[model samples]
Target: MKSRRAILAELFLTAASLMALFPLAWMVSVSLMPPHDAVGFPPPLWPSHPTLANYRELFAHQNMGRYVLNSLIVASLATVLSLAFNVAAGYAFAKLRFAGRDRIFRGLLAALIIPGQLSMLPLFFLMKELGLLNSYGGVVVPFMASLFGIFLVRQYALGLPDEMLQAARVDGASEVQIFLKIVLPNLRPIMVTLGVFTFLSAWNDFLWPLIVLSHDQLYTLPLAVASLSREHVQDSAMVMAGAVVTTAPVLVLFLALQRHYVRGLLAGSVKG
Candidate 1:
C-alpha cells in the first residue's frame, strides 16, 4: 500500500498538472464555441453547442492552409539544416583535436550570455545585404545552426567511445567515412531531440519572420494567426480556432517524440 505522504504527493502533482493543462483545454473549448459566445463578461468553461464552423471559416477565408504549408516548409528545412550543421560542429567539438578548438567553444559559451534580441539589427542588415528578405530562405537561415544545439549535441557526443573511432581510422577509414558510418548512428537520440526542437522553434517563430517577410503570402501560421486576430478582433471563437490550428501540429509532434526527447536531454545533461 502507498504511504500517506506518497498519496499526498500524487494528489499535489495531479492538481499541478490540471492547473497547467487548464489554459490549453479552455483554448480548445472556446474554439468550438459559437462565433461570439466566448466574448461575454464571464467567459465560458465549455461550449454550449460545439461546432467546426470556426475551423472551416479559417481555412476558407483566411488563407490558413497556405500559412500552414509555409510553416511546414520552413520548419522542415530548418530541422534538416540544423541537423546537418549542428551535429557536425558538435561532434568536432567533442572528439576532434584542433588548434583553438577549446578557445572557440569557450567563446561560444560566453556569447550565450548575450541576449539574442541584440543581434537582430545586425542580422537584419546582413539578410538585406544578401537579398534574402521576403523569401523562404530568409525565414530558414537563422535556424541553420544554434548555440544550444551545438552544446546539447556536444554533450551527448562526448559519451561516444573513442576507441571505436580510433580503430576505424587505423583500418584506413577516412574521417568522413567514420563520422558518416559510426558517429551518426550513435547520435540518433540527440539528433531526434534537436530536430524536434528546431522544428518547433521555426514553426512557432513570429518576430524574425515578421521582420524579414513583408508579403502576406509569405506569412507562417503564427503570423497568419496574429493577422487573423486583427482582422477578426471580435470573433474570439475564430481566433481561438486559429490558435488551436497554430499549436496542434507541434504539440502532436512533441507528444509523439517526447520519450526520445526526454532521454536525449537527460543523457546530455548527465554527460555534460
Candidate 2:
C-alpha cells in the first residue's frame, strides 16, 4: 500500500512538472518551425522542418542583441544596488535600536497593501522633473528591491544571534564592520533569494520602461519583444523566438539559485 501511494505521488508530480514545462517546450518548437507554419490552422507541436531562419532574421534585421545587452545591464545594476541597499536597511531594522524603529518598519509593511500601479503616474511625473525620462538612469533609479524584499531580509536577519553581535561590539568592531563581517555572512542564503527576485523583476519590467524609454536604442528585451510582435504580427515563429531570448536568462538564473532560494524561504517562514 505504501509503495502504491509513493508511485501515485511520483506520477502526479511528474505530470504536473510536464504540464508546467509544456508551454516553454511548445514555444521552442514553434520558434523553430518554418515561419508561416507556426500560425497555420493545424499549428504543429513540433516543427516539420526545423530551421534557424527565424533566429537569423531576428539577429540580422531586428538588432535584438542590443536589447539583450540592455536587459543584462539594467538587471545587473538593479540586482546589485537592490541587494546592497535592502540588506543594510533590513539589517538595521532587525537589529539596531532607535526611537520609533518598530513603528517605522510597521508603516513600511503597511505600505505594501497599496497597489504599486497606482503610483506610476506620479512616478512618471517625478521622473520628468528629475530630467530622467527616456534614459537608463530613469530605469535604474526606480529599480530596487521592494517592500516585500525588505520584509524578507528583516525576518531572516532577526535570526542572527544577538550574543555574537554583542561580542563583536565589545571587541571595538564598528557598526559597518559588524554588518560586513557578521551579518552578511549569515545572510548569504536570503541574499541569493532576494537577488533572484530583484534581477528577474527588473528584467521582466515593461510598463515603466515603456513610459520612460521612448528612444529605440534604449529599449530592453521585453519592450523589444513587444515592438517586434507588433511589427511582425504574422510571424508567430519570430515572436516565439524573441520570447525565448527574453526568458532564457531569467530561467537560467533561477535554476542556478533555486536551492539557496528554497532554503532561505523555508528558514525565514517561521520568523516572528
Clashes of each: 0, 0
**lDDT tens string, model 1, 93-191?**
999999999999999987777776788889999999999999999999889988888998998899999999999999999999999999999999899
CA lDDT of each prediction against the hidden true structure? 0.90, 0.86
**Clashing residue pairs in candidate 1 (N, C-alpha, C atoms within 3 angstroms):** none
